[model samples]
Target: MSISNGIGNLQGLSNPVTPASATVQTGKEEQIKSSVSLAPGAVKTTPVTDQTVISSTSELLTRALSGSDVRLDKIQPLQAAIAAGTYQVSSSDLADKLITSLLK
Candidate 1:
């Protein structure tokens, strides 16, 4: 089974490679969209229609806002992309934090 940082049916799967495989094909309208599967019951072919990407993002956000430890391996690529300038942080967010800190 395949897992993303926020989404997927996961179905008690613990390993990466098996008789089955899943890959995430992230996109614009859909951020961390997953595609590709394998084997008989391989990737738990649930539509994931009920679960929007927003739900997934919100779940991860709830964990973050709670200050819980997250799986770093799941986030390493994003960190690298940001560091490499392939990704960006909005100036609005940065400025908001700076102003909030000054007010505090």
Candidate 2:
């Protein structure tokens, strides 16, 4: 098998190099470019508008607390029904549940 040589052998290339002038454009020197709009409807996105914007962290906390407190109040009736022995539980269903618990 023949061994191949790499870019290491092509060293010291470009015998003559001439210095060239560089151009740098400043903000003021930059040209203002405009494109011809052919589309009838172009998407124009306005800045994000929050229907419900929490002004402060405390305000957000108050709003969340209000909703959670209302939901917690609903569990009171279910708790009362179970405590008053009004909640009907079948014997066979109870035995099945116990058997399921024992199997687990």
Candidate 3:
């Protein structure tokens, strides 16, 4: 078999570009712009109508994140009691709490 090539092979193919029709309008309306003339030394302030409020949970979380995880009020008394050799903890209660945390 021999290869054939010529413009005759492309006779049925349509042109890729399309020309615009005369019925379509191409003109656009001109927009009118005016300048504002304010009095001398006049200041314009925009009024704010919306305000953002922080939820209680978000405020508490922000405070907790900024402050230490350990509370000073709870830790101070415990530290003092331990230093005075009066701090007592039950073994069963501590073990139960540990096991409960592990299960969770």
Task: Choose the strongest candidate by lDDT.
Answer: 3
lDDT of 2 at 96: 100
**Local distance difference test, candidate 3:** 0.66
| Model 2 per-residue lDDT tens digits across residues 11-34 | 455422222222233544332211
Question: Where is the poorest 10-residue window by lDDT in model 3?
Answer: 28-37
Each model's lDDT comes to 0.65, 0.59, 0.66
Q: Residue 57 deviation, candidate 3, in Å? A: 14
Poorly placed runs, candidate 2 (over 4 Å): 1-74
Best by TM-score: 3
Query: Per-residue alpha-carbon lDDT of model 1 for 1-104, expressed as tens digits?
Result: 95588546567555434332244335643322333324445565566556435678898888889995778887998999988989877999999999999999
- What lDDT is obtained when candidate 1 is compared to the true structure? 0.65
- Candidate 2 weakest lDDT stretch, 10 residues: 31-40
